[model samples]
Target: APQIGPFSMSDGPANSGDMVSTSCSIVKGDFPVEILWLHNGEPIDQGNQDITITKINKHMSAISIESVAARHAGEYTCIAKNRAGNVSHSTSLTVN
Candidate 1:
């Protein structure tokens, strides 16, 4: 099973056009863990120009937005999965 730890996000209640980021790390899990991001419970598109998702390390991943918009304000979640099971963490973004 996968166990997630130390999920973090940049300072929130952000202003429009501000860059923002969030990250998730797997403290314990099988090798080759896959991490995915969701916005308001919906899958986020990795092809979006303003958003970027990158692996910080074998056990960690991060999502960043070059410039946030009102539509981007919501609950963001990161899910880590492996052959055993899955784990997730979430945070909210508020735009002013």
Candidate 2:
């Protein structure tokens, strides 16, 4: 199974137009791991210009928001899956 580690975000509440980012990493897992970001249980829209998803490395993935808006405030989750199994971690974003 895949074990996730060090899932985190910026230190404090974010303001409108502020940039926010988070990272998800797999501490123990098999190869060919798939990582994804979701907002309130729904997949994030990659088509949005302000959103950027990056594969930091083989075991790490990151998502960044160039300009956070009111609608951006919600539960953000990072899910990792491989042939063995899957795991997820979630964090909340507070926009001011």
Candidate 3:
């Protein structure tokens, strides 16, 4: 399996702080594909962010980031897990 996420994060506003939403995707299965976000190397919480997913196929899924801010700028990942095993991937964010 292949894990992909974070994709990219872009800064918002020149003199003010704003949200920097991003997105990620992965494969779907009978198990859960854990889409996790990290800020400054810390794991993000579900209440702080909304994780989106869709059944692209028997083994495919999707995710999204909304109202992301500078604090939300960091590495994001998606862990696809099943009875077989698990796989994960991450990406970085830059708010400048």
Candidate 4:
């Protein structure tokens, strides 16, 4: 089985127009694990201009949002999975 490490935010509550980032790491997961980001329980599109995913390393990844709006405030989830198993971590983003 694999585990998704804790979710972390680059900063606390963000104001409208502020840039924010969130990240999670994979543990005990096989290589080529798929990493997905969800906002308010919905998958974030890779082509979205406001949001972007960055691969920090083999086991670490991050999602960044530019000029966050009120709608960006929601529960964010990081899901890491492979053939063996899957794991997830969630955190909340508050925008003012």
In terms of lDDT, the best-performing candidate is 2
Per residue, candidate 1 scores C-alpha lDDT tens digits across 10-77 of 66498898999977888897888999989899888778687799989988888998899898888989
Per-model TM against the reference: 0.90, 0.91, 0.51, 0.88
Q: How far in Å is the alpha carbon of 31 misplaced in model 1?
A: 1.0
lDDT of 3: 0.49
- lDDT tens per residue, model 3, 19-88: 3445555544444554444555565555543433444543444444454445545565555665656666
CA lDDT of each prediction against the hidden true structure? 0.85, 0.86, 0.49, 0.83
User: What is candidate 4's lDDT per residue for 18-81, written digit by digit as tens?
Assistant: 8888778887767788888888899988788888989898788889987899888889998888
Candidates 2 and 4 compared: the better one by lDDT is 2
Q: In terms of TM-score, how similar is model 1 to the real structure? A: 0.90
Q: Considering TM-score, where higher is better, how would the candidates rank from best to worst?
A: 2, 1, 4, 3
Better of 1 and 4 by lDDT: 1
Sort order, lDDT high to low: 2, 1, 4, 3
Candidate 2 lDDT over residue span 1-96, tens digit each? 788886556677899999999889889989899998898888986686767898899899989998999888888898899999889999988889
Strongest candidate by TM-score: 2
What's model 1's lDDT at 37? 89
**Residue 68 lDDT in candidate 2:** 94
Return the lDDT, model 2, position 94: 89
lDDT, residue 74, candidate 2: 84
